[model samples]
Target: MTDTLIKVDLSQSAYDNDMIHNRWHPDIPMVAWVRPGDDFIVECVDWTGGQIKNDDDASDVRDVDLSQVHFLSGPIGVKGAEPGDLLVVDFLDIGAFSDSLWGFNGFFSKKNGGGFLTEHFPEAQKSIWDIKGMFTSSRHIPGVNFAGLIHPGLIGCLPSKEMLNTWNTREAELYNTDPDRVPALATLPYGPTAHMGRMQGDAAKSAAAEGARTVPPREHGGNCDIKDLSRGAKVFFPVYVDGGGLSMGDLHFSQGDGEITFCGAIEMAGWIHLKVSLIKGGMAKYGVKNPIFKPSPITPTYNDYLIFEGISVDEGGKQHYLDVHIAYRQACLNAIEYLKKFGYSGAQAYAILGTAPVQGHISGVVDIPNACATLWLPTEIFEFSIQPGADGPTIFDTKGIDVPLAKDL
Candidate 1:
């Protein structure tokens, strides 16, 4: 662990890098090996594998293929690791590469990958944020700057073949229910675009056709996107295969809870300094079904917030019974409307909720006909005072400051 165990060439396509892969399968070979107690570095490309750029154009965000996403670094094998063991990972530190101090935040198109609130925002859009040491800001969205809560948006161990099959079967069943639905119910394996690290020819082909898409968080913890799992946090991951083929990427400089925008967060190309250990038979002992973690010891503190509440009622006034999803969406929409009162555009306000250290909570679910949800917008993130007053809201001169957009073709 004296040097970087895995390094990525940012200029190279992730599909061309033997150390990177987009699918998860036990057969995908580990690019490196490490024993318990080892500490090392692993570099990663942005989630879209550099598909999005620093420029203002959102066409790349609009045209990017969702199938070739989330290019991750490593299934780094750990010696003596076995199934049912817990792979204890300590995130010692994380940082954006000095050479690439910028990242992206965007909303995918409804026809492409519609997000949590896609119906309200049906088109593709993007905003680029420049990282300055521990803080980040975007020229596209004016009047705000804050410290980042950096973390890896996706990280986990490879699943056993049985678990992989279970994922495909269940997801396929759901997908089959609405095969032609926009944004898809589930992402199935696509062999042609799959990157089975270090595998070639027939073996690669066989694994690719069955490999699980790294789109959702499964039992082994792929793409959970928890903003609290940042540097200084520790995770206990369930190992389903020997060597605990651990892989991680999709780094973010900052992300609000829910990552409402599917192409959400201040996505970045960065490095993680981690230390690993094992707790043999700990999974069963702890009755763990999925990954668990301790919050980062060092994280951004934004206590002052403006909280917005929403019920299970839809935007069109259609009432639904105990639907947290719809409630949360309403809460997010409520916050965006509040931001607009201060002169921020709808898109810019939406982007802020996606990238800033905002908080969302399922406030109440047993309230009879309606579920209650709350969205907490950190007042401290804004330069101007956002607290409500007797004089109503103070509108800022936002004129031209706005998030970039790319209309669907």
Candidate 2:
């Protein structure tokens, strides 16, 4: 297999810069056909396109056209790929829009899909990061800078007809049951956000009511925002359509574990060099139904840290009743209290934890009535000294909050 570098041009429109497809539908025409072993450099527009511009400020966060959230670059078809097979996308290199790239992390808002702690914090916030080589620093939130590992936050193939129907049906049912939760499936844009003419793209004149949204991660892998898909990573997707109508977009300069707060980990416009190959009958072998990828450099050197642990417990005397969300919230609360020691207000700390280089892990879910979650905060990013909390009791110690333990039960 010889390396033939191909460039998929996405920098085309006046607004989008590159001609990119904001929608993903099986009926969408293939932008290009690459033979197996052909390497390509896909130019990805920033997740926002023109909805939010370089000159824009945090106030602009509210005006962002929510409908056009993820602007995907292509439905690049692989010549011989087919459904049920595993399409292997080899990420050779991922970086800035070109030599220079800047990104933003839009804070949680009530109008858009709510944040991890939406009820508590409803106001919007935006932080801009200047990307230089491997480093990222923001002036808004002074004192922290970290190496940026670039990767496509959203990448996947077109879903089969059956799969698409399943997606729509399940989504409809979910919305039908709870109108409030409907926002999860689709958040109406704050203003006029979508430029791609309605009923005109891949979903145009097709069986689908509209293009399948590029929000949720599906069998056809749309916004799976998992970090570590940097250089030398193998992303495998379960092909659902002929030629494995592959698409990629929503490149993130860097991201934390849950991307729990904002539109997600420092959203940016960039290019990812990909080389795709096929794994015939890989579905049967792996018994996996969706996209799965082996991230390179499996373990990362996450420098420094404060660890906050939380276990899910309910009111009264309860043990084996576990709520993962409660456990996660507990971890967040612990981290927030810890951040207070460093001079950050609770709300400030909440947004920072959501946007910063923090990592959250499910330490233990099998521990009977208590599922544990741990949040790891990297110390190196702080401009100030990393210090332990005071000798007295901490928030977790006196808590009747997010954490799951029933102390005086």
Candidate 3:
């Protein structure tokens, strides 16, 4: 039988909200029926959902309402999707409809009160630029290549009532106990005062107000805009509710590593065409429970441990750099301990791992953690092999011997 797929248009009329959530309305009917392994195309409206016509200024950013800003398309139910299956979403293609502009005022930017840069620059300038030619103009510093990467900013499932209420009530109590905590919770545009008061009444009762949906996950799915999850990469997500209730939003054109500022290289909207498939009993097939699972192997063949040492040197005549020296020593010790976990002799591991492992250095300026190091393991040394009957081996159980073969090793 031929593969069945569906086509959705975010610009269509079937969606409920006209604001953020409506940009990629989920109410539209399927273009066609679909099953596992089917490929489909989806046409998306820009984040504005066609509300802000051309000639809109960057200040238009303020016009977006928080409640309706992040409109997503659909919870496209996957056929035969059970609570125990795995959904393998391959990002086949992503492109923008037109040139767009995303400035430093949105949720992802640090200009906001709760952002990472808030303390660094209490009063900072708002940066804005034209994204019309972003695809061609935007480039990684010192690198000649134009940027190209795609990741979803929002993707998740409907949560149960218990989970929803627990979060709401917790927030309310926290706010009431300490009003200063309000700034910490300002990541989004929700009405802070109203939320705090509502939470105070009855945390559990307030949970009944609205079901929770779209929580971020680090387990391997949903709003994990990891730069590595790009074209040609395979991602595995565990199925929770029936059909997995899958949806995708916050399509980013490109982003940097760590997503430090939380903003991507470019935030724009367009059509994202992809293929979806299922591995029947895939979750159990791979020993994963949650829909999100890490792609790395627990006991990798080659590994590197990283440590960062931040040193502050006082330029006064005394010449003190104690903090820097301590940080460096701590990093070295961390690396040694990390290598020992993989069956390396202290001296050998330090010598070999230090030379072979990938290293990264960064400068930490005023009011920020600085001077960091990263250890990278080459994928070639250790290959991911699935064992049908075992949870895999532990480094301690191995008694300090490296497993040579991926399977028996």
Candidate 4:
């Protein structure tokens, strides 16, 4: 087993400095050839590509170049892969970048996509975590610590050139109509200047022009930051092109469900132990095109104490559309109001909310007029007082909950 494991390094090639770090052009040569049954151990770099160092501070965090994010590991060619096959990747285990365990979490510039709460906390701020053993400690927010969940924030294959073209055309149209829906060039990984990491040569230029921006979660699974995909998680990706062109990076020590404020989740570099295999004709069998996954066991130590509820609803039903953002924000506002009873101001509440072990969930989206989102928070972190339970608000938890599918299903 040891001899069968291939190692994929995360450094520049002799010819192209930005080969594996900044760009994601399918034309870039594959670093290694992984067979269907091959086991591999990948050495991945910090998502920032040497931009943010371990010893860096919050000021340094603010200075980070947005273009250099998501420094990934491979375009590792799977020996027997073809389009439409399911590339099943099993995450065996994950570890810290090296012996020195440290990571950073900060809010990105508003010029970028601007995290969910970007307007709430405009100035960039960060917490440097001293991650060791199984827990993470932060000096920025003292007296709170929690066990970490190690997982690749990004794990998937490249989309076909046709699909890429469709995405670009659609997004360009969206940009022309509503630019806010698309991230700014500062935040777009595919933007021209974004082919960063010592941009040189023609392939680099083409990649810079055509690389898929690693921001949204697409069918190709670029930056799907699902938190529960810790060690032992098995993921299935739809292969859109030959060899599957698989890549992985953006490792997170831990993250909540929403990854709410986005510039996110205990960002760190680590070793990824993966087993690659394939399910022939799986796309037709499952009738799905995006990545599918089975998460490992969840943290049993913490129990959800508060569940904030929100709906894409208002006094007038005009605003009650299918926009999840409306529901998500309402749920977040519920959490903010809940935090206010504990003596936190609105902005401070949103900032701390982003870092806290809180999760957001769309309980159901199929509702006719009102879609609902729930914000779950753990009571374990609060030492002083939490409203309603710790002598605070008169929040009646009962008579307010609705069972949507309970009645029909």
Per-model tally of clashing residue pairs: 0, 9, 10, 0
* Candidate 2 lDDT by residue in tens digits, 1-409: 5332324333454233333566566666676789889887777667776455454355567656566667776678898898878999998877775544788776646666657766655656666778877778765555567776677888898887677667777777776676766236443222234433223544454533445667778877788887878888898899889999787877787777788775658888777788889988888889978778888673346667888887785323355466787788778877877776655556556656755667888888786778898888887776666657466423222122211111111
Q: Report the number of the highest-lDDT candidate.
A: 1
lDDT of 3 by residue, 1-409 (tens): 3222323354553233221232111222222335788776554444344433233232343233333334455556678877667887776655665534431212222232322222322221212223443332211111112233444555554333344455456655655666565234422224221111112235423332343333234233555655445455555676665666565666655444333233323455665666678877887878984454232121213333233342443223233333443333344445446555544434323322222223333334344333333333232322222112366423422243321111110
Off by over 4 Å in 2: 1-19, 181-208, 298-300, 313-320, 389-409
Off by over 4 Å in 1: none
Shift in Å, residue 148, candidate 2: 1.4
CA lDDT for candidate 2 = 0.68
Cα misplacement distance, residue 381 of candidate 3 (Å): 31
- Which ranges of candidate 3 are over 4 A from the true structure? 1-33, 46-58, 98-113, 121-134, 138-145, 160-182, 186-208, 213-215, 218-220, 284-409
lDDT of each: 0.93, 0.68, 0.41, 0.68
Number of the top TM-score candidate: 1
| Residue-by-residue lDDT tens digits, candidate 1, 66-112 | 88987999989999899999999999999999899999999999999
Per-model root-mean-square deviation over C-alphas = 0.9, 6.9, 16.5, 8.2
Model 2 clash number: 9
- lDDT-wise, the better of 2 and 3 is 2
Give model 1's TM-score versus the native structure: 0.99
Q: What lDDT tens digits, residue by residue, belong to model 4 across residues 11-129?
A: 54312433354555556556578889888787666677656555534455566666556667777789888888999998888888566488767665555445776665555556667
- Measured with C-alpha atoms, the lDDT of residue 124 in candidate 3 is 19
Q: What is the TM-score of each candidate against the true structure?
A: 0.99, 0.84, 0.54, 0.83
